[model samples]
Target: MEPPSGSPDLVLAFANTHADGGGRPERFADVDGLRAWLRENGLDEAADDASPADVDGVRHLRDAVVTVLLGHSHDPATDDATVAAAEDDVRRVAARHPLVTSVDRDGARLAPAQPGLPGALGLVLAAMTELALTGSWSRVKACRNPPCHFAFLDRSRNTSGAYCSTACSSQVAMRAYRRRKAGSHD
Candidate 1:
């Protein structure tokens, strides 16, 4: 569905994906996909230049998303309420960033935006914006096992997917073993 305008959560969701069943990330990939999502979500469909967004613009916004994923200054006991609050934080960062929005305000409005982004870049931006409004952004996460930075959606029926891969989970188990063994000397 369409995301609220200038929403960071949408941006985050757009930029991050579990690639459905644990694979590489997927997105609009171009204007058509972007427009489809926008239209699906009832967002603005203004024509925008199809050039690549400025490196600093897209990357910094991406960093904001990554920062949140890394749980920057976040309480570890994150629940639904916490994720909702985080959506606002992402919105502010992305709205202030270059490509997302050039203007800043104490309270950003979710209005229809004009589109002019290149295929890949626009696709990413559009998806992220949509994610901000929807709870989809909440599912994006990094592996907790510490070795795997790979991102995934916590879609397990029990809402667990804390490890990126089984190997990482095994590694964490191995470390726990070493720790327990070392503690035996005490």
Candidate 2:
């Protein structure tokens, strides 16, 4: 599916790499998978040197990003401790792949301090920074559905998008109805 309007393409693409609330096969499960993903995402340079360790690192980054998106959705399922841990993971990755300010006639922006995998990951972090600066970061959220916590951009007027799609919303409602009915039987 197309990324939500106003959402950073890089961030959306990177976060969704985990795929289908992680029920599906991991996109970065191995070196070959990581290389393929990097190439598809236009990070061809990183693809060449993709390694097993890089796969682990990228997966860690993706998980942290997904957790942050869940928090953005204000999903009650995502606890404070989980968000905190994710944030900490992000900080640790950021330290390893620091971004530097680059200014020119086009204005200033964050760029990677390193090359290869670090640089590619830095680009993802930069996208998050850009969105946060514009106050649109919160709009990038994960669906509330436990088995389908897909990341999406909230397009609601009040930024109240809770699920990724109507199907998820309907599923949640149906589940709630079943729960209520079951309780009524007691």
Candidate 3:
């Protein structure tokens, strides 16, 4: 398949696309490639809507991704917790490149080629780890919505990315249409 874009935020945001379209999980290279990447990555896709108390920062990240990506909300109260966790995960991954950084303290040496992004980050540890370790990584991107939160990689050669998917574009268009119909551009 075509490789993903290069930006870290974009990678994180686009973490859970239905890359396989089989409607079943396991048809992917990683969390991004899994048909149910979001659920698999969060480690709770199969669990019944977990309680917010169980939804720690890590769980929140996955849930928020689901909310933004799938429009799913088993419980709306968990929204805040999910958002916080997602943000933290994004920050942590963004800060450390598994490719180039030494998680160990003593001898500075290149780590073994562990698989996946975390491994890649440990190996390279750079702003461009997503690109250098994975496919051309600089093309990662976030949606261009003011209140909307989504991420995607720009495959366009010109690199003019502004959204996670056409659905979002359509949503914006529909909102605009309603506003125009009502003659109220709020």
Candidate 4:
């Protein structure tokens, strides 16, 4: 099934696989879970070809991507060291498994330079590249609330989105309100 409307397919795939869902983490616990996610994302055709090591590799790459995206989304300016590190991590992975460019009857496309884990990561990286080129990379963000690192697209006109949903936003706001209320009474 497709993700909710307005979300890019690739971002949805990564976010759904890596993020917390309804206060519960949905990360893969084993190869079976990873395979299930692959099936869910219509990548099942390549699932059989992935080994246990490939699954581990894919998970690592996913985490790396999350780190990089979160780092960028949180702050686009003021080059923080952590953001640089996250970017370096992603660059290292991308360099390790580069994507190959090819032209077909339809148009140019990107393919993985290597099969298996690299191929899966290459597809994700290619999607990220597309977002970057289109200036939509900032739209992919991780919720600021601790332990709720759900990735979401900032569809707000001003791009000020900081949480996954109104519920999360309300939760944070309520906490702040209580803090101020308590401080005022002190």
Candidate 5:
């Protein structure tokens, strides 16, 4: 599915590296996979020297990001402690990469302080920062469906969107209906 309007492509791409309800394999399963992902996302320089540790770090970052998005979706399953931990993880990773403020004729923005994998990851963080500043971060949500949990931008007029697609919403509704029917028999 196309990324939701107003979502940053870099951030969305980063958060979606893991398998989802669609059954896609982990994109960062190894160094090679991570490198390919980086290249696909236009971080070819980082891809050149990608390492196993980088793969692990990127996966951790991706998980943290998805967790945060799930929180934004207001999924009841996502508790405060879980969101807190994910936020901490993001902070730790951000510390490692670091960002510097760049001011130009266009405007001031954050840029990676380092080069290589860490820098590329910093770009992802920077995109998140931009989104937050523009109030678009909260709109970036994960589907409420347990199996799916796909990250998507909520374009609803009231920002109440909870699922990545109608398919997930229907699946969740059908499960609820089945449970209610079974409970009635019980």
Candidate 6:
């Protein structure tokens, strides 16, 4: 799963690693599970070298990326502060592990400046940085519906995708309809 050729697929996959639908536990339950994720992302060598600390670092990075993307997906007019805060968080992490520039046939790409916990963490950050630089950050988002919080790419023409799937969107819409109907009764 080398990022699926999509600009934001890696970011979405990183965020989905800890998806908590309903009352279910995290998708990656432990360090081993995190290793599985690394392997799934074609980072088998990184997974082999991962530790508990590495798992935690990946989780932190994933959360930070999700927060930033969530900010992008939400209405910036009213959520400017939230977006700013999330950008600050991303900057803080980037400051800790700066990315380096690399050029190939595909042009320049950002790579981890230095080896940090779970070597793949830097690569993940690089992918996110690329998305931000390319103005595709909003394509990656967390579902607005609570509990699901699954990350997804907004492929809609107007970029109005707020849910990971139609099921979640329908559930939220139905709930709103019920509320409106009940209110009219009053």
The deviation in Å at residue 85 for candidate 3 is 12
Best by lDDT: 5
Error of 1 at 25 (Å): 15
> What is the C-alpha local distance difference test score of each model?
0.49, 0.83, 0.42, 0.68, 0.86, 0.70
- Tens-place lDDT digits, model 1, residues 72-145: 22324445465555556557654543344323566433332434333334444455555545766556665555
List candidate 4 stretches off by more than 4 Å. 1-7, 19-21, 75-79, 104-107
TM-score of candidate 2 to 2 decimals: 0.92
lDDT of 4 by residue, 1-186 (tens): 111222357765775576464656555656777777766666665566666666666776676666665664573332467667777877888899787776668666566676654566667777777677678888888776655667778899998888788888888789889999999998
| Estimated TM-score for each candidate | 0.47, 0.92, 0.38, 0.81, 0.94, 0.81
Residue-wise C-alpha lDDT for candidate 5, range 1-186, written one tens digit per residue: 111123488888888788866787899999999999989977888898798877787898899999999999999999989999999999999999888887779677888888888789888888898899888999998889998888888989999999999999999999999999999997
Question: Tens-digit lDDT track for model 3 on 1-186?
Answer: 112233454335333332222242322333333324334434233223333343243333343343432222122333666646655665574455333334445433344233443332332234334364566544554454434434455677776655557876677678779889889644
TM-score of model 3 relative to the true fold?
Answer: 0.38
Lowest lDDT 10-mer window, candidate 5? 1-10
lDDT of 6 by residue, 5-77 (tens): 3277667777887757566556456778887887787888777877776666667667766666666567333
| Cα shift from native, residue 93, model 6 (Å) | 1.7
Model 6 regions lying over 4 Å from their true place: 1-6, 22-25, 75-80, 116-118, 184-186
- The ten-residue window of minimal lDDT in model 3 covers 68-77
In terms of TM-score, how similar is model 5 to the real structure?
A: 0.94
Q: What C-alpha RMSD separates each model from the true structure? A: 9.3, 3.4, 10.6, 4.1, 3.5, 3.2
lDDT for each residue of candidate 2 in 1-186, tens digit (9 for 90 to 100): 111123488787788777674366678889998998889987888788778877887898899999999999998989999999999999999888788887779667787887888788888887788788789899999889888888898999999999989999999999999999999999
- Screening candidate 4 with a backbone cut-off below 3 angstroms (N, C-alpha, C), the clashing residue pairs are none
User: Considering every candidate listed, which one attains the maximal TM-score?
Assistant: 5
